[model samples]
Target: MTASRFLDVIVGVVRQHLPAGVSTRDLDGFMDRNRGLMESHIQRQLGGLLARLPGPGSASAEDPELPELWTAAKRTAANLAAMVVAAKLGAERRNPTAQERATLRGYSGWGGLSIEGAASKFPEGFPVPEARGLIHEYYTPSKVAAEIARAVRDLLPTLTGEEGVIHALEPSAGIGRMLSAFSGLGFEDLIWHAAEWSELSGRMLRALYPKLDLYQGPFERWIRERGPNWTGRLHLIVSNPPYGARGAAVAEDPDREYREKRAYAYFLRRALDLLAPSGLGVFLIPSGFLTARTGEMLTLREKVLRRHHLAAAFRLPSVKPGGREALFPGAMLVTDLLFFRARGGELPEVDTADRGILEGSYYREFPRHILGRELGQDAGDDDQTKKPRWGYQVEGEFSRLPRLVERPICAECRITPLLKELDPKLARNLRMGVMRTSLDLDGDALAPISPAPPRSGSAWTATWRSCRPARPRSPPSSGASCTRRCAPG
Candidate 1:
């Protein structure tokens, strides 16, 4: 069925049975992780039942809406059973593929694989349901893409391969702005792999990179399936993931933090997980990932710090005057041009998830939130033993400092995180698709390839107004590079 039709059916089901809250903003779709999404769908439906009832401030159990809302919930649950049975009967009429079966298991489990030893590839072309209704998808304009690509150009040749081919993946390829940046640079032998949730975007990417491996579905499912095989095989991974969207919850990860349902979190975690040793990743994401301490985000910091090489994370202007970020709808978000690499061995930490201490500049948080209660507390030091807070207040400071801001408040940023550290030394390699034999020539014997020189098209300059609210703002100039952040207090 067409994606719109599927959505229509979903909407119909929500309106018919769970009419109290028909919107599926909290609904989950099929994954490439489609099945996990199905459970989310059911969960959202259940939530709607509560929505129909009288909320806070309403009189008690005798509320008139309770009966109708309760009935809607019951009908919804019963209708779901009937739909499952009808779907099963319909499936028996024609032969269904294994992927189809896995999708049905959505009411059951979540699972896929394109790994060499795996059974099959991820279910292709499945419409990824709305992970979280909060996802506001915006395309990266070419001007912005160019700026980002220039920064990534330098991080390339550091990850050289024998055949000179680079394997890169754009987990959320929308009209291929990132792909264009990839080819625009000096590289030609890129092994393009991309996934998109919508078929319309998928078709566009297919036209752009016809021969490249293009998978259709939610990226969470596609990448997880093939992740085992391609893990550490992709030299560079680039993406502007959907911000604030929910993803399938991973329940059994050892770190406990890996269970985040935030779509960007899922994408970033996987992006870091899939990079080959020293392979780079360029991401345009919300600034919050670095500073967020709630739930899994803190441990996610540990993962990013320990598992990946510390690279530059430049704050982008969210609302620069005359800048593209300012012109675009929903543009006033603190954004960042984040860079990192896959570290092979033990990597070091930039900061900690420590609480109360609040010493770490990047990741610390206050012991108690400033809920603005009438409690007589001050942001200043304890009156009994006052001391300077080093500009980091011991109270009321929260995690996710401005979430990372964009510059010019409005400039477009085109970037490329071109990386593929195809180490033949690693037991398994990408090009060879197997364990490397002794006969294979290590890249060391091959002449070294340098990063492509920066291409000059538009002036590569950007400026953001001084963040100091009361300070007089400086007029931005052409070719102005203002990366003044994290200065010592």
Candidate 2:
């Protein structure tokens, strides 16, 4: 029989044997109890098929058609075994756990691929496996993965109850490291599911977490097939989704008019759509999500603010000592760990402060009420000059986190008129092109001012003021020091 026919037969056998009135819990228990017996039955059936078609079309047969028939038999046998495993697991509505997965692996070798030096055994024109997408193959740092897991663990209690099975999904589960992190946390009866686009990574993940509800292929296609039932079913969603690129077509959001459809944006939107009303989502996303003015990025931000309760944003370091990048290694990518929850009951309050700096790292909370304040029309009316970076600030610092301010003074724009507006004289002096200060990489003190391009990756502005320094005075409270005034350059 063909692979499809074999699969149909296996599924039929499972359906015929399934007991009526069995609850999902009971079904799961039943499958576990009968695993050995189920394996034996499948083995026996496979053995029968093999006996009838052993070595397909004997070597003595001169017909060319005989070899093709032989290939089909071999293909059907492997496919049939895999189908049996899938059918049994489907009956229980659960995936094979590690041990159960290993048991199933015994049925097939090379995962449908011919073993090395065994290629002559199969058809000559067998298709080669497609190459995996480079965007989907990016590696997530171990420290970042552990940190995200910890954050998810802290947020889980807020979104779910203590008992019963809770489902968690990793949309881009390369190598299953994130899944392993969740498993290590010891959450009672948690179900791990993943969707990986790379065949190689998916294989690795499947090998590492055999019982994973794994989907191998583009996440977008998998979402389309499985999404309808996933609505409000997932308790937690965590991922370091692909960035910078676009994926399979996504229906335009008529309401948001989102123009940019980068892969990471789609992944985030899908994750949110799949999240239960009380679910928590933790993502390692580009820092630009907070500040990018592109229609798609803005639309995504607005959607997040309006739909979810923003909990905390942990701004991770983009650069490291010895002039190396942290998140993307050879490339510079400023990243943030965002933890948010779908709107439900009251969200817990946190202690934060305005423009707070904690050990050179930035952390902020985004309460729902003030979420769109920064994006509001009035907030940007004064400048009309688009500021490239923006972030939120919590009401207090460290001790008592309370309210949140949607737009806080960004470090790069501190010396700009935006921050000194309250003091018209100072704002005027700064905007008039005053003292220019360039960064001194070796020292903390303000070096001599000159007109030059700012050092790459350094926050220091090459020209602070267009004219000569008037004099040194205790810097204004606006945080711009080395006060001076000069004519516009």
- What lDDT score belongs to each candidate, Candidate 1 first? 0.43, 0.45
lDDT of 1 at 379: 24
Q: 5-28 in candidate 1: lDDT tens per residue?
A: 233234433433434653333333
Q: Candidate 2's residue-wise lDDT over 1-489, tens digit each?
A: 222223323432343345688543465466557756765666566756633431211111112232112343463354334434544554556667755553333322232233434444333233222323321233555445544553354334444533456778888886555665564323544687789876545654554455679988777666668764565567788888877556444542332333345667777866765665547777877656754445554545655554454556654544444333233433334555666665421111121332222211233333342221232121111111122234222121111112212232112211221211113343344334334433332222232222342222111222333412343231222223321122000
Estimate the TM-score for candidate 1: 0.45
Candidate 1 wrongly placed segments (more than 4 Å):
1-135, 248-257, 293-296, 322-328, 346-489
Worst 10 residues of 1 by lDDT: 456-465
Deviation from native of the Cα of residue 122 in model 2, angstroms: 18
Deviation in angstroms for 414 in model 1? Answer: 36
